[model samples]
Target chain A: MELVGISKLNADYEAAMAVRKGIKLFIDESAKENFKKAGIEVAGTKVEMISDSQIVIDATPDGIGAKNKALYVSMKKPAIFQGGEDADVAEASFSALCNYDEAKGKNYVRVVSCNTTGMLRVICTLKNSFKVRKIRAVLIRRAADPREVKKGPINSILLNPVELPSHHAVDIKTVLKDLDILTMAYVVPTTLMHVHALTVQVDGNPSKEEIINALESSRRILGISKDSKIASTAEIVETFRDMGRIRYDVPEVVFFEDSIHSSNGEIFLTYAVHQESIVVPENIDAVRAMSGLKEKEESISLTDSTLGLLRGRLV
Target chain B: MELVGISKLNADYEAAMAVRKGIKLFIDESAKENFKKAGIEVAGTKVEMISDSQIVIDATPDGIGAKNKALYVSMKKPAIFQGGEDADVAEASFSALCNYDEAKGKNYVRVVSCNTTGMLRVICTLKNSFKVRKIRAVLIRRAADPREVKKGPINSILLNPVELPSHHAVDIKTVLKDLDILTMAYVVPTTLMHVHALTVQVDGNPSKEEIINALESSRRILGISKDSKIASTAEIVETFRDMGRIRYDVPEVVFFEDSIHSSNGEIFLTYAVHQESIVVPENIDAVRAMSGLKEKEESISLTDSTLGLLRGRLV
Candidate 1:
């Protein structure tokens, strides 16, 4: 909830106020109340300077390697790094996953790779389990702005850009390398949430009910049930005018009414996940799990219904 | 090259001028062409006339047994019986396929259902040969025509009177079943061709090349190939002078392209094949294939150097 950094957004005062809510002011002297200068430490790092920030999520653009490495090394504690298109990163730079247990005692940790984090949280739950068999995903994405390159029905992305999707599959491949996984990703024209079309071939002829129940057990997946619900802003997304950056709940198993065939005995289950929120659930929980404040369960329940709660393995 | 039929469609009216160079015609006032009224002399327990020109394709459209049995009796020599919705057609109705070899002296042969036909063709192709573990096909189609109550893409059909693209998958499916064929069918906007999206899981890792090749070989499959040739001309169709109703050379294939991913992967081969042409290729071959035949081939060969004959398939 505490927003920080990128003190100067090179934006107008009105634009800055419109984008922020709390109006916190811990940014560099040049930064206004809304934005902050990312003070990344280490002399040669991409960030201008590093401060004693508790949680440093390096949201850097693609294609930066050595600079980010220096930032991570400069950290007193492990830090979370996000390199959007550069998800195919080196593992040695970040892997607090195993140490989260010990680090939690110290109240700290670092993360790397958004794709790896998001896919891992969702896919890990599917791995170490037999209920999952195959995976197919398609992302309905929009450019950040419309003046951008043309994307399939995108909301807005300004530059003429080559929208991408499959690149994440490779990043995910490396993240889940220890576990057997396979993924197929596609990009659509949308802004934030990446909607995914998923298919899971269970070990046997498991009834639809069983599949639903398995999905309900994963903390990363949301299966429809009495207690389940799409995160609220969605309940109010229509209310906010100019709320162009809003997103739907991730792992929301939407029924593609267009692709269902009861006569043929087959169906393709689909979902959408916000890139920003993808790590929120796991990041909060990782601190707890590493600190021994939580018990190791077989799976985490993220949905309301029990129908196929496992975020099905990448394959 | 000869152009002989009940109608000398491609020739000039030289007959009236007493010329010998024109094609021949076999004219008769009463003859059966539509499958149902075709003359079938074979008599069996299933022999019974259900309607004047229309034979009950199934035992019953709404209720009981193999109504198509009536087709076995009404056909002139051999005719096709069909089942729409959930009608149960007798396997015996597909006898035409099984006994085609014996047709040296026999009269009729029956066959399987349309969905079954599409299913078999896809599963038996080069991609699977028993190497595939499962296959799922989603067939989104339109109603055949308006004379019947169409149950699909409901709102669109109600407002506009357009061509439909349903039932195209039946033939494709019938030709490739047994590979865990699960199909989903839809009734879309036009009365043209059926659209389908298929995913097949084989023994090995899925490959794009193999999938493309498998689809290319499916005679009923359209809209695929390295050339993005739009292998069929369904899209370019319009009201033309000579042809009464325009269609694709491979309607099933063309329809399939509409069902699968578009924009990405791109359509390499696509085009329309006149429906009448499917039934009259031989006659057209005599006229056009051999067009300006002998002399043209000689001149083309001399100028083409070699391998020019291969261009026929391209044209």
Candidate 2:
């Protein structure tokens, strides 16, 4: 499959593609000078590129994804909407670990948000090995991405919804219908990563080693011990940079191995989710599932391998 | 009682007392020019100030308080140490609501940290009305005070202690011995306030109204609803500024009434603790208790009233 990029904002489009490769790119002329300076040529706008693409990833800002749905539908192309879109805009609210089956061969699949994706991976990993009963999570959210200077909470903490069972839990339920979960979130003045304090209550007692082993076995979960000198989100990003990850993107959940505590059928742990990239692998897997190109495990493996999520320090 | 300020650093000493009045002062010449510009005169260093003082509030930086303990003892003066010092530095880790009796007439009393002071108010308030069996708190801590430019976690979240039962729970246990509590903390890039997601499990089921009324009756707990337009820490700080609070200090715990959730004998709620100011009233009450000036109820009332925490929008 060939990859194509389209955007009205040339600068944003150029910045995005500069980190990776895209064939047949289309963007406005706003960034033409910068592209010239960098010895890169730009292809002007092309609305007709949709006709050649099998699946479209509608990652436009929040509400715009819903508006773009009509264009994709008219072209008879499958599209994967982002978490920002309304759940009804797609066939399923997707998490590769939770509902790959539901998104398989579907016209549209909405990959859940960063926090939800991170929680689902842990819950699903445990559910596969135990009778998971209930879950409670406190999401310490980053105020904005490092590049979004216009965003804030610059010196404060915000209760985004100012209520219990923040929308994250509701969004997760859309993908894992029968799972019991509750979430609380506080938006802090940090642009790096989100930290989740999760408690999973199961039916019977599970040893800490068993739970740790299960989480370790998951390709998308990166466990780092306290002694590893990678304690905070800052260190995690630096580690990714040291490993030569483009844009210092950490696609896997950074689970603190020392934080794992289990007793009386309850498991408690803390993990950091790189909001910018945790959903990338899920988005790639969604495309594969929706296009009927591969089965669940195979699609996940392929996506993980392509993203280098299954190799090096991430493993 | 006369108040005297003493600091080796004149700038910090001047900054602290400029907001209030002190009969005698001591500091270096670092802030002499600024003090002159403000029409304020700074007295030279006075190491002998402790001789005439009955009770000294040793607000020195963390370990410094423990070291200063020697001087206080040498002068035979009663002193109040801050949370930074270990619990052993004082007669009791003092929380006015938790163990005022233990600190009364003591030579030294250590008021707990801002987060601990905030949590103890809520937990103690609930424990007064219910049999608080266990408590689990997730402390979303501010990275530093707004003035501490050198402190950071500027773009990342640091899991302080990177372990369970962060020192906060251990500190609380020092005062309320035999109380079952567990706390987790993450330091985020915010200098305004610390937000806590607290879960209190009691013996018998209590109605939401009962819990709300119990919290509302506490002088140190200020309840704000979601519709009150004081949802986040930024709004809370802005409101305090509009209220004409000195340095925008909020000495009370700003409890989000809308975040209160009660079910199956468990009470869940979220609150914001202004890190710079939440410990102020606690320090005042510690002074009264340490100097044997007033009983718990009377001292708390005096401190709350003097700090204006009992008036205006706070009520």
DockQ versus reference, model 2: 0.74
Real A-B contacts recovered, model 1: 0.00
Give per-residue CA lDDT, model 1, range B52-129, as digits (tens).
222222212332233434444546422223333232332222212121222122222223334444334344443433
Clashes of each: 132, 0
- Interface alpha-carbon RMSD, every candidate: 13.5, 1.0
TM-score per candidate, chains pooled? 0.48, 0.91
What lDDT is reached at residue B60 by model 1?
Answer: 27
Q: Report the lDDT tens digits of candidate 1 across residue range A1-315.
A: 233433333344533553454443233344432233332221211143345344454444544433555655665534444434343243322222222343344322334444445445445444434445544433323223322454332211111111222455555554444433334332222343444334444454544454444445545554332222322212222322233423323432222222211222232443434454455545444434434555434112321133222333211
Off by over 4 Å in 2: A4-22, A27-47, A311-315, B4-22, B27-47, B311-315
lDDT of model 2 at residue A61?
83
In terms of docking quality, model 2 is medium
Q: Least lDDT summed over 10 consecutive residues: which range in candidate 2 chain A?
A: A7-16
Candidate that scores best on DockQ: 2
